[model samples]
Target chain A: MEWFGANSFNFEFVSSVLQINNIQKSYGSVRALNGVSLQVPEGSVYGILGPNGSGKTTLLGILMSVLRAQHGSFDWFDGRYGDGYRKKIGCLLETPNFYQYLSGEENLRITVSISERGDEADIERVLKLVGLYERRKHRFATYSLGMKQRLAIGAALLGNPGVLVLDEPTNGLDPVGIAEIRDLIRSLRQAGHTIVIASHLLDEVEKVCTHVAILKKGNVLTDGPVTDVLMDEDVVELDATDREGLRSFLLTQSLTLETDKETGWIRLRFPKGQAKLEELNRTCMQQGIALTHLSLRRKKLETRFFELTND
Target chain B: MKIAPLLYTEWLKVRRYWAFWGIFALVLIAYPGISYLFYTGYQDIRSSNNKMDAMLKLMVGSPFGFPEVWHTLAYIASFLVFIPGVLVIMLITNEYQYRTQRQNILDGWKRDEFLWAKFWVVAALSILLTIVYALVVLVTGFVNPDMALAGIEVKSYYIGLFALITFNQLTIAFLFGFLLKRALLALGFFLFYFLIPENILIQLSRWRWHTGNWYHYLPMEASDRLIPPPPYLGEITNPADYKQMLQAIPEHILISVAYTGLFWLFCFWWLRRRDLT
Candidate 1:
């Protein structure tokens, strides 16, 4: 459901909420983040997608100031917010870190006091928002993994901050819990919060993220609008009686950016939304080639992620 | 940014924690109960025989009475300082075990703020335990059969010294917790260092050579020597040596204060530079 008004969609010139510049971090001999940089636009769901150990958490940790970077710097809200900038941003990094002995409500109270953003009254709103209102008085130790995660998100939402940084937010959630969190993130974005999510879940990122950065071994392989980074091109499977002729004719078309020969089919790629299967077939027929197989396949983010990291 | 909010935040974490209340309860019961036992034991020795009673009265004076009660209680209470030391270690290491230290910084606290928050907890707890020690002293002094309110003004400085010792010891405990980042490990190391190693070193230095006074300047040793034993033991043995040791109280206090400051400075520097995770 669209929680924000239509005017919120006007993105002609969106300012950046977080600007990371050339940050580098290392652990002994292993490099965790090597000169990584990105810009999270205001009121957008920015996703940092990568495989395990690809520095997704490291980069988020650096941005949140929990981990010190060996080199480079970052700015939140263009550094206009001063030292209290962190209070204006809600963050849940890595795991749900709360006092195990305290109840869910009590834990949020501590969070509110530390951030000094929301009052005790806001704690109930946040608990209800995360679906933990029913068990608000339950000790955090008694919470299931999903409940604990929900409480963490609830704590982050306590202040209604302008920016939210969530690292592997759906880590311990079940299917229903994951979907609920996904919707929560979408609704939060609709409410004008700029969310920066770090996740290896390609499907989740593709569904909710507006922008994405794919990382491989401490380096960002590609990043930008999701459509540009993950689905930059459309794929068409073309098989003809004469394979060489089909490949040769397809290469001459300006629409075809890449042509690959699979086992029994020829794969042709065109820029996103530039692929016209009927026109391609007609052009091939006009060249005296009758197509035996022709179909369009949308590039899945999972495939793109593997293709990027496998490099 | 202010210390009050940070302390309030820490109070929320421990207010419902059973371990915190458990240690506090132990102190309330044990501190006074142990002092009563010593008072009764001294009384029993004095009333046993006529000849021994005369000699004991000459040597012991009125230990549980007025001015001496404060010093006697401070020394006895120092032995139980490890109880609060254990609480400090548990509280700090629990943050590490749960990874809440990183969360605190992520929530809004600067690195130094987090360390300062913990230091405040250490200071607050020290002051609280010292208050309890003072209350026990007043009660013991008033209830003793040989109580005398005349010289009560003399040795009251022992209460302030007791507070300093508690603060220094707990600060050391905080350092151990920060370094180890594990509850069991920090507690184990603290107990080992406080109980076995430092004592062995101090005794070895004193008995094996003539340089025992040098070893009294160790972290816990300096604080322990602040109160020393009650005056009765000195009167029974070498009074001159005891007076000499008493003169060194200022040096021991300086060493204790320096160590406390050094530990906090080291923690602030280390925390600001190291990664929380």
Candidate 2:
């Protein structure tokens, strides 16, 4: 819970900082990102939501200076490629490529050596934070994919950087691993580091991000506060043996059904202050059909994410 | 900004990387064995003819029959062949091959800064290797019981040391590595075309030569200044002995340093302008 820089709004105070403006990028004829502009606020968790091939990684790569942009520019807060600036930005633009021959500790040590802010204790602290302290001495080549990913995170954490920018940080994780990473990211944010995570997992982003940006193709679909950007309407999902019967009943009862894709259930979006669940259940029972399930679905970041990035 | 720790880390990288250690072991232990085997083969040929030039050729490995210590030293360096060139290539290319360059470049190291450190390390290794070769020659003279080996001297060792370290050789090597973005290929190209005529001229000028067939001042001929020469060269002349000649042209040290300096400037400019990707 320690913030490094307390600079102004015009000045970035996020231990991590990225400022991009109308950035455009293309690979051959494929436009990867187009006219995307965003400023990640200081000391908050920011998330990018998009579908596959939605330019999330492309944006992160540009911020890391790993890839160049055809148009627009960026500054890694105050210091744009400043001296020793990388030491302040702990970024996992993608899965890290650690030395396969080296142990987690050894790999961390090597990165720490290269970092301007390197301290020996940081190696152990980051290991502990990511819940891989016990496996610190294990060779990276022998680690499980999740453990390798954790080790990669530990590498970025070396030298105790101010901000953490992770692209798909919870990629390929089981529920437990996902929860653990979520907790770890939350803890990092509490420690006063600004974090920007780009992920296709909208639920994960919704649970953690204070701000959100949605991207589609090579364009910024929309970006803003998580609540404001995603808040469409509260919804309720209805599941039963005869979804057509339930859908007809709900439509007659004044509820709106969105898409027609049936993934083994029927879902309806009811406006706020409109669900009389007990009465609906009574009616369904009277209709001689067993109600398999009913659950109130919050206006999810995922729906907005899909809506913004669908095209 | 903080160079000490970075240098230590790079040192550890080379120390721990298997290729570096493997090569280091070969250089230290195999050189003497290889040299002895070479001489043994030469002595067999010499026995058949009873010719002194055969023995000298065995010692110096040359067709230009000169007897100076400097020419002999050049012969000794050539035995290592592309090792020095390859070592410089490995310095950056290994990092690229391993995908460690991005991390290193992002770890507060500018491209030029990283190259500069590698430059220093390569220079130091070159100096060390040259000195060791020179010392081996000195030791041979002091310890050899044969009267024929008593004339070996060790001055050109230091001269070759300067040439090897100077950016003259490494700049081109590193330049090619940076441009190709592959170490082995660049080093291979350098080694394959190393002795070719026009290629040396182009490298000598950094493709900047206006003079025609500018191969005269190349390392191939100038490198001849390093050791005892083949028998056909008229006479062996020590730098100290040729006081008048020494006074006439620019000093060997100054020219070597100037060439290195100019090459580095070109390297820096080109590196800055090119897209490193």
Candidate 3:
């Protein structure tokens, strides 16, 4: 409560901006989401991470009210508002969905008009924010993939929405485009907006997300803060002069928790900051094993993602 | 949200739509062009003979006046009804093609508001066409020797009725567009329904069911009845012939209203039931 009260910068005092309970969706025989549930706290950058064909996009579609879920429900802002609650939440679902013949400025005008916020002042502001202000007059069909995605983000930013829901905002972009979008997302979060992103990019999730949920085959395997869920552990790769002897020796040591041996190196997993190279060397010396190659590696979200969703 | 802003959004989408503008220009040209053709053909007939029947000449010359304006403008308008029909189909289908309909729902528009925005567009279209029709009538009045401003009495009511008739035709297109979600397919079926299927049904009703005259009360036929052929029996404009033609106005109006209401109900039900995806 103290952290939520003091650190929370947004005006809303509510802890959970979104509460999704047991959301289930299916496309005919293929189940898109199976009993998925998660909560997004206020002022948190929430990332829904999964592989392709997982329930990430389906869940985002349902939250945007574009697709109907067969089961379960979700409430936004604690049900403080009715259907109009969508006005406070902006969304860019799936791809950049805009009228191709319309100019970027015109498309934003249309979005602002639909929002009924009664002004186009934010249109220019958002265009500038997305770095599309100079090309605001260009037709959407003429834009590159990066520009199209940026225009979509600008449209989503209209009316200064409190919650921004972006589904694969950086998909199909080059390295530079991806980096720009990542920076933009981080900047938006820094400005105190709750951002919910659904992505297959684990590196992006690690870089921008404060909290994350890993999904596979329509089921959420785990969800929590980034530190607890993904970056909580470290991996160690150590090899001895006698490889077979070191494998047997690692299985007997208390410091070595989970051990896997490849042809070249024996990999050991331990809690972050707990394992020391000198301590492992002492153990190797006592076991009559001479250490040849020893290297410490930090586990990335990619490694944890593979671990959780492998099943 | 106020409807004004929604309408503005709708306008923003269509104002720059080239196809919509192209169709609008086509309708504007086609209606007046058809009217002028009739006028020139009438003039040629009169010039070929010293006396080409006084009443026939009067009917042709006063094409903008009451009774004749209703027939001429309404028939001309129906010939171009497909223009607006295609426009509505494209407008509705473009949303589906681009998947902006999903974006719309996400942006806080109720599904009903989205539907209403299209209806508002229809309303604006009807008024614009009606004004053009009125302008054509005015030009016809200024040129024709038999038609003066005073002779065009009861013209405003028929113009309103013509606008309603056009809206009724557009509603058919709207229902098909919403249900089909593809412009080409909806337009194909729309043209097929109006150009061939309705005629087949009317003919089949007469031959197979022996439902003579009653087939005229069918939805499309009833709207067609609103604009019957001009009351000119070859070279005669007998009062009894005119009365017989104008007698079904009330019936056609009632049937059109009922059909429009039915189409609206179906549209509402379908929009509410179908997922945006």
Best lDDT among the predictions, by candidate number: 1
Better TM-score candidate (1, 2): 1
Tens-digit lDDT track of model 2 for B1-277? 4556656777767655677667766776554555555545645665577577456655444321112333443455544645656767777676667566666665556667766766677666666666666555554434333424333432444455434533356555666676666877888777765657645565666556666533434543333233223322323544443443334234444544666666677766765544333
- Model 2: how far residue A36 lies from native, Å: 1.9
Arranged by lDDT with the best first, the candidates are 1, 3, 2
Q: Rate residue B106 of model 2 by lDDT.
A: 52
Please tell me which model should have the higher lDDT, number 1 or number 2: 1
Chain A TM-score compared with the true chain A, each model in order: 0.82, 0.75, 0.80
TM-score ranking, best first: 1, 3, 2
Per-residue lDDT of B3 in model 1:
86
Residue B55 in candidate 3, Cα distance off native in Å: 6.1
Task: Kindly report the root-mean-square deviation of model 2 from the true structure over all alpha carbons.
Answer: 7.4
Tell how far residue B198 is off in model 1, in angstroms.
2.1
Best by DockQ: 1
Please give the TM-score that candidate 1 achieves against the real structure: 0.89
lDDT of 1 by residue, A209-253 (tens): 999998888998999988788666778887888988887877776
**Selected candidate, larger lDDT, 1 vs 3:** 1
DockQ of 1: 0.72
